[model samples]
Target: MELVSLNATHPDHGGKSFQKAASVVLHLLVIAALTYQIRGVARLPAHPHIDARILVPYAPGHTAVVHPPKPKIIRPKEEPKLAMKEPPPPPPPSSGGDPTGDADVELAMASFFPDPKPDLAALPHGTRGDIVIDIVIDQDGKVVDTQVDQGLGHGVDEAVLAVLQTWTFYPATKSGKPVPSKQRLLFHFERA
Candidate 1:
């Protein structure tokens, strides 16, 4: 036969609560101690007798002082004061040589019709005449402009004009620089 005893209040429950609180506090203290121990190991050496002369401040009178003579900005010497005067006249050139004859523009080479005669069928059958073209030779020895000074009927003028467009010339020169020079070119076409 067994008898059962039941009580609502138990002292063991309070004791277990106290033990749980103490265990938590002890665990926290241990963790804190380990953290501080690691931080101490990682810190830099705290040397007590280190020489600090490099960090010392300079004494008041120890700097080298140089007092230079009052600096005078030297200025350029002024030109002798001149009363406003007219410039001197240039010397006259000698009259012995031809001034206009300084450079002669002989067409060192003039562009000409590669073929003076074209297919007769291509041209209208008629009296062909001569056409004089005026050309302006520009710098760089290139023919820049051309105009038909004389026009001939029978397709002669257009043929001459077309030929002139392809022509080149040695440009006129003045002071060794190419200057535009006017030249006259004649294209003669005679019907046989």
Candidate 2:
């Protein structure tokens, strides 16, 4: 015959007394609960009877009646009588010649020049710069586009462009007729 001992060197092997105490306390609690429940049941009276029935709510004697809406009657509209006014007399033939009258005239070439120097304001004191821009002229001899070709930094360039916009441009002509053209213009600005 061989004997087997359950004790081991590991720490988990201890606490046998604590485990036994916890088990005893739990068993006592369960037994006490069962005894208390049984005593309450003994105190109750013998046989009780109960009855079940279906219930319904009370309703009113009167109910609502829905009615359809009446159709609308449309009245006819009367036509308005327009008074005939004599057509206004044809206007006299215009003295101003029509622009398309001389279609054969070829465009005449002309150089662009500013009638007067552009006004520059708000320039920084003692600032000096030159701005070069390509100006586009329309057939009516007006500056259409003032694209900056070479610009001076700071607000000087903006001032120059603003002034150039107000200046009149001489439109290039071909065969004596005004035509659109692009020309390079330089404005030297100096603040004294």
Please report the candidate that would top TM-score against the real structure: 1
lDDT of 1: 0.60
- For model 2, the stretches where C-alpha displacement exceeds 4 angstroms are 1-127
lDDT of 2 by residue, 29-97 (tens): 886664433211221123334332222222345333323335566766976788999999996764333
State TM-scores per candidate: 0.39, 0.35
How does each model score on lDDT? 0.60, 0.60
Model 1: CA > 4 A from native? 1-108, 111-113, 116-128
The window of 10 residues in a row where model 1 has the poorest summed lDDT is: 36-45
TM-score of model 2 (CA atoms): 0.35
RMSD versus native structure for model 2:
25.3
Residues 13-128 of candidate 1 have per-residue lDDT tens digits of 89999999999999988866644322112212365455222112234456434333365578769867769989999977642222566643333256443655534454556656
